[model samples]
Target: MKQKSENQKAFPRFLGILVVASLIGGVLGGLSGVAGYFWEDHTAFGAAFAHLLGAASPWAMAACAAVLLGLGLYQYRKSDTAFHGWDGEDEDVMQRAEERLSWALLLDSLTVIVSFFFFNAGTAKLPQSSDGNTITLLVIFLVVIALATLLQQKTVDLTKKMNPEKRGSVYDMKFQERWWESCDEAERRQIGQASYKAYVTVSRFCPYCWGVLLLGNMVFHYGILPSAVVLVIWAVLSVSYTREAIRLGRRGQKTE
Candidate 1:
């Protein structure tokens, strides 16, 4: 009973973190877009693109913020209901709700990171040519998207292994139900905790890194440090956080 109570408390705290992160991300992203528009060289096609994004940044971020806030509210309401009405009968529903919440966090975090990148690049004064740099940027964008997709697929595969019934196949449901029936409560809780930790760790990583970068950029503008130095720091932090994410993913895999 005490353990269950602790878990309940942990979830709300997590949701609170999610809400705060989302709000911060939206604001920062919008600010970045505006700054980029003003700072970038206007002659290049990239600059024109950035300027257009700057014009739209605030509205785009506002929409994202609304969605994130809505998700947070929905999670809070669901948590309240689960707290008061939870019974063994609704375990599956509770599990699904948690999974959905995790996915929401992941999506929100990615949105923020992408917005930050737009702002970062938009603010930079790239070469005025519509040549190699543009091609390189496009290739990098595609690679990033591909990597994100692969990671998402890996996460989904891990989830399927953890809960076969989660795939919505009737055969898998029956098989997994029987399999899970044989597992002890401790084992089940271990898997759940691992999965939850993995999701939360990944979701928090990007915002934290971007937040640092944003702060560093602010400091740099005051001439307290070189932009190159700030970029180095951002690079180091990003690599470290990425490594941590990989470690968390591996830990989740161990549960399977």
Candidate 2:
């Protein structure tokens, strides 16, 4: 019962954090846009800021990529020993690691996309004499992309190891069947219910905010095209998961 309660609490906590982050991002983005719009007429601050950004962006991106790479390497190296004696506590630890890695993958992917935009914006602001700066920025972009790819693969591998039974691939039928055979009806129902809740929550909430952000960017000419692409991806994933969640929910209900 306590575990179930904690599981229920986790959803609300996740939602709250997401909401707070979204609100903060929205406010900061709005303020930056406003400041940028007025920058030309009011002060030299805009140009200076752009110059600083162009100078700093490469280092910033490289640092972020390095941190992600370090984390991924650490996780990959430690995961085996961490799960050596799999018990309920180990299961919980694995679940937490899975969740953290999933979020890391999502956020890091988005960061890479944002870095592209930042690179473009910075290069546009650069003077023609600074050809070297442009090359440096390009190199940083490539390095960040490489790091992001490595981190993503590492996270996926870790997630698969932690939850091999949950992997969704037609070729994995044998493994899936074996996993299902290992679980009793009650365990299956619990899994189904949990999956249904997670998918439904994301499908219900994520698309609405994404749509708002997409429309806002388009109308304001924010040049966040990657966001639009991400929105579409999110919509597709939400729909796919919603269908699966419904199927799982129905199965759980029938079993009940």
Candidate 3:
């Protein structure tokens, strides 16, 4: 209570600092805008863009795709190695490796989606956004998708061989339910911790994102739909969290 009161006492000082900072920022911004209004050679940005976005984008996409594929292959090999070499003794190590492989598999699925996107975007910078380019990109997309899917399946199968209690089919509609139900108490706790962290992170970010979206709508006339969507999501999350907390409290789930 003393610490809280002390901090509260400093609030006016902090508010004064904030006010000063805002004033200085506004003055600097006004001067910069005035300077920009008279400045020529704005086309210098365009001149630099060809080498940056136009030329570098394709290579960047290729590098990203290669790294994703390489990492997936590396993860597969690591899992395969652990699965093959493990005696019954290294259970903890096996568990750690299994966790890493599981996360890698999840990320590799994202990689396939990105491979599709980056390949498409990279190819779009070509001399022509032609039918042939589209066809090639689609082929690349399918190939990566297949490769990522098969690799994940093989990794999961290897993990299952080592531990038969795991359950989930990729194609199953209720896979999350089955997999979650199959989790041991420790795994469930881990999931709970992960979920709480995600919730907290997003909660912290919502205000900043909301402020930025509002600024975007106000300054750029980007429309209220974008900001409204964010608010709707934030509202849903807030209500669900509050409702769950209240329900749990009522059910006597609170710790003593």
**Once model 3 is optimally superposed onto the true structure by TM-score, how far is the C-alpha of residue 126 displaced, in angstroms?**
15
Writing each residue's lDDT as its tens digit, candidate 1 over 1-256 gives 9999999989999999889978987887777666655545443765467667644544454455456545644654454455446575867866765565456447645755664564445335445434344454444444444544444444444445545544422235374565466566886888668866765665556556556666545423334344445456656656776797799799999998
In terms of TM-score, which candidate is strongest?
3
What is the Å distance of residue 104 in model 3 from its true position?
A: 1.6
By the lDDT metric, which is better: model 1 or model 2? Answer: 2
Give the C-alpha miss distance for residue 234 in model 1, angstroms: 14
Candidate 3 segments exceeding 4 Å error = 1-62, 109-113, 116-131, 210-233, 243-256
Runs in model 2 with CA error above 4 Å? 1-40, 72-80, 84-90, 126-130, 165-256
Worst 10 residues of 3 by lDDT: 50-59
**Which residue pairs overlap in candidate 1's backbone?**
none
**What lDDT does candidate 2 reach at residue 60?**
73
lDDT of candidate 3 over 1-256, digit per residue (tens): 9999999999999999889967866775565555455343364664465435434444554566678767877877877787678787978878777876876786687677777666655565556534454565566666767777777777767766766898987667887798799889998999989889988998878876876665544334458887888888889998998998799888885565
Give the Cα lDDT of each candidate. Answer: 0.57, 0.68, 0.71
- What TM-score would each prediction reach against the true structure? 0.32, 0.48, 0.66
Which candidate, 2 or 3, would have the higher lDDT against the true structure? Answer: 3
Candidate 1 lDDT (Cα, 0 to 1): 0.57
Pairs with steric clashes in candidate 2 = none
Candidates 1 and 3 compared by TM-score, better number: 3
